[model samples]
Target: MEQAIVIRSEIRKCMQEEGFTLGGFSKATEIRGSYLSLLLNHDPHKYPLPMRHFDSMIQALGKPEGWLYECYVDECFITGKTDRRRVEPFLLRCAELGKTECIERVLSRLMENLNQLSLVFEIAEKVHAAGNQQGAVPFYECVAEHEKHQHSETLAISQYRLFRAALGQDLHKNRFAATRFAPFRKRLPVEYQLDGLLQLANTYYTLSDWRRLGECADELIALAKVVYQEQHQRKTSKREKTPLNTERHLVLYYGKGYLSKATAYEKQGLYAESKKCIEGYADLSWFEGLDEVGKKEVQMFQIFAVANSYTLEILMGHSYVLSEYTNYLSMHKHEILSGLATILESANKYGFSVDETLEMLSKEILEFKQREDLPGLGWRLRFHYYLSIYFLGKGKIAECIENTLQSLDLSVIINNSGAFAQAVALFELCRGQATDAHLNNYKGLLEEVRKRERFNLGFHNY
Candidate 1:
């Protein structure tokens, strides 16, 4: 029998098993009897099933979710037609529904041909880009595991992306993925290795694993040194060197390493050490020809470092540095609001009148709220989070709670774990002052988040 005919028979059997008559099922599902019969009888020349009907029919017949689609995809695979254009919709349907078992079956078949991995990767990227990080993690893991033995840069890049995707899904899973970074470290091109380390450092930051972040930053800084020295040696060995314009990228790369190290130190409360690293980042010379986007990113880091330096100085009683930091801030646009917000929080802590700063913060928040073109919502959420802190310090519990909840809402929208973490922390801080119902509400939400986190990590033993 034709595979499609066999699938149709299976569907009919499922309906019969559920004691659902064709006319009754059709009426319940709002699918016309004639059309339903055409679909269930499997006329080979009939158009393929629409995805919407598959789910409705599955429910109406008491079949498992994705059962019909999975069977169809399996048939397509067996008939050697899985690569046909028509099969893409079925494959994507499986991915959209998070049918890992079906995806795994498809991956197993594709593994026999290395060239077919691209299709698998495309689906994985599609899942990840759709904000389904959990669904994408396993697919990337499968690809990385299978490709590891291939000893290609492709495998290394796959491993790096998998590590990132896993981190997004669960920090605990990423802890295991981190170990896989080593073998790929030596296999990748130099540029890939550098960027990979930077990416790993970012994951460490996300996990708040300061020690690991510092370690990764050390490796990045060392690699940057080698690149810098090689360029310097080329200049000395010959009277000519690569375009100074190209050198700007190298400088920014090295500066990124230093920036990482500085943030790690700051997290550890080693203010003096952090300041030195940030200064090193700020001292790098910029050359013309660096693209505007790169320049903007690098400048943001520089301004952030400067702002952090101001906070550290104030905390350490070196208040004299505040003037210098404020002078620099005065020159930049209001987009530097993140660092400015931090400074405002510090100012309130030290008895400085924050009225002016508070006004500025409110104005910026209002402005951002009205503008639809702005991106960087994560940063904006963090700004709201910091605003909550400032309000708490001022003993404005209502405003503090308001901004904290706003931060939480925005964090949820953007899926920013770091901001979400801070928002939760703020809620915990407010529990003592809040009513019993509010406290219980906070506890319940936290517990739910904790449960989901453990579940996503596959912590079955726990």
Candidate 2:
């Protein structure tokens, strides 16, 4: 009440000092004089000003944006209840202006009545759908924090959005987000469940947790099949068609289900099982209801199937396919990073020399190293790791140590503990051969890892 009164009084004082009558002020602000007079004279405790009018007055008075927004948070309440008409727009404007304190104040008051959860969730969806994902985090966090029903769809969707928004280059954070959202995956709408499972599988893939990745892939395949079958049945029957609003074309979910499974198996060294899963999506072109996008996805899967077949052969010690695989990679530049990694790994495993192949793809390797995207970084880390192994196997001690240090640096940057452990162990085994410069670089990387660990520990503790 006091804050509201102070705002009104300040407006009145500004008008009086500027020698503007109510009529003049109203004209400048494009508000009616009668309404302006009522706003100034009415007891603010009983009749709070609307946010739009207050905004107009601020602009007319040449005040900065978000002038009196702190006090405006009070105006959003009337008689101790929220006025949705005022609060919603005010909240959005606050978000636009980066008035986080005001947003928190308004949300704190709004949450006092748990009935506002639906409204809050709606605003979160609107913000998220607008591509302002970070802005929607607070609203989603508020709903997830106060939601009493663990099984509620609202809670599940909030968790799903939070999980999607939280994903980034940080593997540790991605793992945490995946774990937090996994329990709510089944509770989401079927459409969300499909996308959520795919996200989980990808996160697990990044973490190198092949077992969990396979589980999510299996669940994704099951749900996608159910949805696909239901759609087919609806099409065949006379029932009115209802569309599913998924993030991607329906076939993507289905194809990714098999693709992710194949990747999980390949990572686990189950080449035969991986080949079978690759074949699962190899001919999804026959899947019904494929639009242009779906057709493209099917074509992409076919390409992946061919590429991964070559990869499996290489991993299984078929040195005969090296030239063919290199040709395929050259034609499809996008596959070069992973392809080269696989080639290097096979070379190390089979005790074969890939010196000519490496020299030929030197440009591609440099480009891969320069890429900073999460997937690019991930593959680069693997490339360096595998390249180090190849170098060690070839008795090139200097090249091995350099690649090992590079891989270790990347592993730390991405917070990939599994790769970091492997790189550290390899480095330890080769420590006696490291030059002074190599040892210095290794010590520096270790310091960086220690600093990051301390920061993570402090954050979690707080």
Candidate 3:
């Protein structure tokens, strides 16, 4: 006789009328099958679903959103079925021991009761920390889907976790996971907001969206300053235990802000500003606690800035910068291929014998070009341009022109001004040896380059 029972019976009737079996409904709504059975067959007075569930079920059944809510008994209150303190330790132990199936079982049971979803979040976090990101992803998705309409903070945390796990997958290389944070941005705490913004800037770099990258860099830098000042005013601990970094969020945000800004400046060909930003990035006062991978990434960025500085110096007729190029390359053996090319080019310019380096580089370039999936259009363009330079250094004029033509073709395809500039410059240098066909194709490619320059998009492709 309970109104809750009546409401549940009506929901079942509506579902049956629409020919939606519990399993079909579960599949359509992405709800767990056992959980759907609990909603349809359990004692509604004891195991009532959340209001959000009613809305989702109704929407899936092509009913009005509030039909189930209107029939619900006012006295039915959802309460926790299991004590979280007792359940969490067992789940955490299972996760720590790598019992993924056991963890999944516990999560499924916990998620069946509406009030036990917090425990689901806790168990998912444990699984994530146990380095089973793929396993944790589904748990986070469940929590987010169930809690999205009513619990903002839980939804934000769950979605962020899901996004991070997806980002870690190699299949997601060309995808920008940070854009998934938009819907949850306002619900995230200040520290997470900063983290999200940092990732957004990284995503912009991946997509080569320079204008947006600059905007995000400026926004993040401003937010970092404000958050740092507030934390300083509160006299918060200088270090916080966090999953992201050992230091406080302040230092991590500050470093990321400058790194992103420097990248934007470098892409815009403002080398001096980029150098200043990179220096600012390196000077952030938390290196003592930075993890090894983080340290290496920062070192790589510094090497990028230094290599750019060296290139600018050479272009401006200051060969003195080459004095330190070899030392820099030696210290950073894992420098980017572009950086390696600068060092080798500098060596050639200085009349140093780079024969061994050029031979090794030629082999490496050939291998890269043979890969089925080129890393990116810009990287491939740079590789071809660098190969041309290497071939020219080896006195192979025909081979050099062949590579230059490849670079020019890709530059035109991608509208990459910087690569086009390099290709055109190389073409001019090689024009003396060109046959009639080469001359005609050169004119067409040169005109395309001129049109691109006239457009003045100013984006650096390399």
**Model 1 lDDT tens row, 242-284:** 6533323665667778888887897687988998888877754
Candidate number that wins on lDDT, 1 or 2: 2
Arranged by TM-score with the best first, the candidates are 2, 1, 3
Task: Report the C-alpha displacement of residue 186, candidate 2, in angstroms.
Answer: 1.1
lDDT of 1: 0.66
lDDT (Cα atoms) of all candidates against the true structure:
0.66, 0.88, 0.64
Candidate 3 worst ten-residue window by lDDT:
168-177
Q: Residue 414 in model 1: shift from native, Å?
A: 8.7
Per-residue lDDT tens digits for candidate 3, residues 120-207, read 8777888887787776776787787678464478789777777666553121232435566656765777767777777667667755
Q: Tell me each candidate's TM-score.
A: 0.59, 0.92, 0.51
Which candidate leads the pack in TM-score? 2
lDDT of candidate 3?
A: 0.64
Off by over 4 Å in 3: 1-116, 168-176, 234-252, 272-276, 282-308, 311-323, 336-338, 341-385, 388-462
Which pairs, if any, clash in model 3?
none
Which prediction has more favorable TM-score, 2 or 3? Answer: 2
Clashes of each: 0, 0, 0
Clashing pairs in 1: none
Cα error of candidate 2 at position 40, Å? 3.5
